[model samples]
Target: MNGIIIGQFIPGDGFFYKVDPRSKIAGIFFLMIAVFLLKDIYQVLGALLLTFGLLIIGKISFIKVLKGLKPIFILLIFTFVFQILINRQGNILVDTNLNISLINIGLVIILFVIWRFLAKFKKFNFLLFLGFLFGSIFIFIYSSFSFDYNLTSFNLQIYEKGIEMSIFVVIRLLIIITLSTILTLTTKPTDLTQGLESLLSPLKKIGFNSEDFALIISISLRYIPTIFDEANKIMQAQASRGADFSEGKLKEKLKQVISLLIPMFIIAFMRSEELADAMESRNFVPGKARTRIHELNYSYRDVLVTAFTVVFFAVALLFRLNVLGY
Candidate 1:
């Protein structure tokens, strides 16, 4: 949960902070669409560069933005591997016969078991661990050990197009995550609510309650950090009571997780009740018109930024469709 950074705001007076929240929100939405429209590696790289540029302009640390990727690291790697294995469009870069035997399988299992034990004694380095594991697997497959009987024989082919597609997928995902991080880091929850409400105000003509919608959005964003904090506290209390969440068998870990989740749910319900009572006491009502302490006002910078985003969207669409012979 700590690895998840969505809806959490970091206070700063950078370029993004000064920009109108509506413009920032719209620009981010457009940029994400543009990123998805891109197919070529060069277009993806350009989008990534632009994302990093926004991060720098917002005074956000690249390390902090990278931290946002932690929760999705495994997913990204899985996507990469899946793409590599399934894609067969281009020429094969790697074609080799993998010798699968009982002896080899047992040795690989033993190696993994040993690695797992070693991981417990110190902090785990994911990159080094994955490198070692894959290196071992690669060496095992490409070794000269041959069995008398061919249990199973299949050629593993890696295509050039697969590599390119995987790279594009990973880079596009990173760009989206980075841009979202920049948005949350620079914009406050209140500002986000205001921007959302302002943007959705046109829907009021169709009987939509924008204020109520905004209130729900604001509360959801505001409670994300609080819920994570409470979860940490609950986990710590469980740990103090001899609960081993980390080094447990699958069944035991599931039981331990249940223990944590039940308490979290109870706490969440209690908090909701308390909030309702507090709001009721203050005569709060849904869909009520309220004046903001800091009203959102668009400046010249906001207009210029919005126009630039429009041009970017147009260019991306044109390139994607090959309208300009890209």
Candidate 2:
């Protein structure tokens, strides 16, 4: 329940929350495509701005997004160093090809800190060290091979398959993740499940029942927190029972955790069985003649969001194909 998972919904009806979840899903896809299609720095920055704007409009705290992103601090620094050090043909901020020194690498890491971590000191420092460690490891290995380019093992073209463009890809992915979180944060889980069922009704002809899909969504959302709470409770209960896990040898404590797994498994199994029997007794069946309690009425906002996504996708395609760039 720590890190990104903590960014889970607190259940509020903010403006973004009132917006339909389906719209949120569409918006995320559209925004991600716009971000991903960029080949220039300008486009990336513009997309980032738009994402933040949308989040603010939804009234989501930027800190929540950053918290979700904290687990990836190591990777962020790795990408930063990859850009600063390996991509160092443009400027000579440092010649730390032999040893660590300030080049574009330092500034690049700073940019990551600002955008991703903001004023979070711990995350910033953690990423900086991670970047340093990555740079050191690479330098060590490369130097071990040879200082001369002639002895280089293998280096591929930058755009051959987009490996060199991973930083941009990751940033775009962040937009998707953030927007998804914002969607869940804003939208009610029950309303979202109902909307999903309605949206998928047409698929019933193809053998997918809206009710089952709704149930799936409902159960999945319901259990995410249940599992988290269950684990936490287990920890507390074990603690109260005098099970000391924080101390003792790692193997010993892991074994202690193993001692808890069977009981957890049995409880989870029985709970699930109970849920199934309840559903069965309620005469739940797929493709039944069940009506939606809440109807989905698309307002101007949904239309606007949809139109914006289409235009953004077109723009992204054009940029990718070099039309806009040209």
Candidate 3:
């Protein structure tokens, strides 16, 4: 749970840390749009390289970036597998018959046991799951000694197009996640809130409560880490009470989940109420104008970032339009 970094801000002395939050927001917005606009593999690779360059410029270590990607490791693997399975548009790479048998089932159970045992090692967590995934696949695919008890069998065909598409999608996803993580890693919550309010100030002319909106966004972002920490604590407490969340039937797992959720929701509500009371005690009015302790100022670096992002986005748009012959 702690591997997630979307809403968690990391303190750093990087280049992005000094840039205005508004500029960072705008830059990330454009970069994300550009990422979506990419059509070909080369464009995707280029974007990936650009994102990594930004990460290095921001002085964000690769370890932290990998940690950010850890939470979505399963999702990425699923996406890769799904894409590979669904797309059969090219030359066949792997053609084999997969069987579900006692051998396969036993191997899978053993693999699960191994995974559960090795999951305690934080550094090899992703590698462990990855190895487990491919090991399971190989076991099912090549285990010829089925003891004449095969439950089902199917032919598995993986094509070049599938592999290409899977890599493309996974890389694209990584790029998107890394870019967003970079923003949140470098910016502070209060600065983000004020920057958003400043950018949304013009909306007040249209009867929109910009401060409320900014505060809502800020609170939501700030609550992410808090909620994850709370969930972890609750899980640990439940585990100490002999609650087994991992090894259980579906029904039992659901019950265990309920046990976790009830307290979580109660705690969330209590925190929200406390926040409300604290705000009220501070005379925090919904629509009142407020002075900032730190004002956001755009430097020349912000201007360069904005301009570079604009160019990058324009080029990506051109690629999408097929104007670059891509």
Q: Which candidate leads in lDDT?
A: 3
lDDT digits (tens) for residues 26-135 of candidate 3: 88988998999998677899899988899888899988888889789889989999999999897999999999898789989999999989999977977898899889
- Give TM-scores for every candidate, taking all chains together and pairing residue i with residue i: 0.80, 0.68, 0.78
Clashing residue pairs found in predicted model 3:
none
Off by over 4 Å in 2: 1-7, 11-14, 88-174, 194-210, 223-242
lDDT, residue 240, model 3: 100
Write model 1 residue lDDT over 28-85, tens digit each, in one string.
Answer: 8998998899878888998888878877777888988878898999899989989888
- After superposition, the stretches of candidate 3 with alpha carbons farther than 4 Å from their true spots are 1-6, 118-123, 215-290
Which lDDT tens digits does candidate 2 get at residues 1-326? Answer: 64334335666655666666677666765676666677865566567777788877767888877877777766765675465434523333333333333433444465556545544566476556656556545653344323333322343223312334455656765766676777667667677678667667789788878888787778876777777778788888888988887899999898879867867788789889998899879987655776656776677778777787787778878888988875
Error of 2 at 90 (Å): 5.4
Report the poorest 10 consecutive residues by lDDT, candidate 1: 142-151
Collision count for each candidate, in order? 0, 1, 0
TM-score of model 3 vs. true structure: 0.78
Q: Lowest-scoring 10 consecutive residues by lDDT in candidate 3? A: 1-10
Give the whole-model CA lDDT for all candidates, comma-separated: 0.84, 0.66, 0.88
